[model samples]
Target: MAFNTCVSVIRSASHKAQMIHNQDVQAVSTDVINADELWSFVKKSKSTVNRKS
Candidate 1:
């Protein structure tokens, strides 16, 4: 029972992370006009991203 519970929790967390990632992809695609725009956005924001946080 303990193993099953751990598996269930892990699956749930994975699904949630996937959903958030999909949302981020959709948001970026909609906001970005083209490849250049996306690249520029990332380049400009690269310094602001927290690596381990």
Candidate 2:
């Protein structure tokens, strides 16, 4: 039961990461057509990388 719980936890975390990655990609696409949105994404991406580091 504990092992199953761990596996589920990992899967949930992975799913969340994937969702965030997808949103980022979408934001990039949106940015291409919109300069304002692009700047917003750039700022957010820099913050995310900083937080990770």
Candidate 3:
């Protein structure tokens, strides 16, 4: 059915993505990196601030 085809496509894409991330990316060394900046960049946003008092 159409649903099964869609599921198969999604799974395939996910598998490919995982392979690339795991294999294509290399480990970094001999360089300085700021943890806070890396976390913020990966998260794609600044820390949340509560509005309620």
- The candidate scoring highest on TM-score is 1
Clashing residue pairs, backbone N/CA/C < 3 A, model 1: none
Comparing 2 and 3 on TM-score, the stronger one: 2
**Which sections of candidate 2 miss by over 4 Å?**
29-53
Where is model 1 poorest over a 10-residue stretch in terms of lDDT?
Answer: 25-34
Cα error of candidate 3 at position 45, Å: 22
Error of 2 at 48 (Å): 38
Model 2 has an lDDT value of 0.90
lDDT of 1 at 26: 77
Error of 2 at 12 (Å): 0.5
lDDT per residue, candidate 1, 1-53, as tens digits? 69999999999999999999998877763543558988888976885675534
Q: What overall lDDT goes with each candidate model? A: 0.83, 0.90, 0.74
Once fitted onto the true fold, the runs of candidate 3 whose alpha carbons sit more than 4 angstroms away are 30-53
lDDT (Cα, 0-100) at 19 in candidate 1:
99
For residue 31, model 1's alpha carbon misses the true position, in angstroms, by: 12
Model 3 lDDT-worst window of ten: 44-53
If scored against the real structure, what TM-score would every candidate get?
0.49, 0.47, 0.46
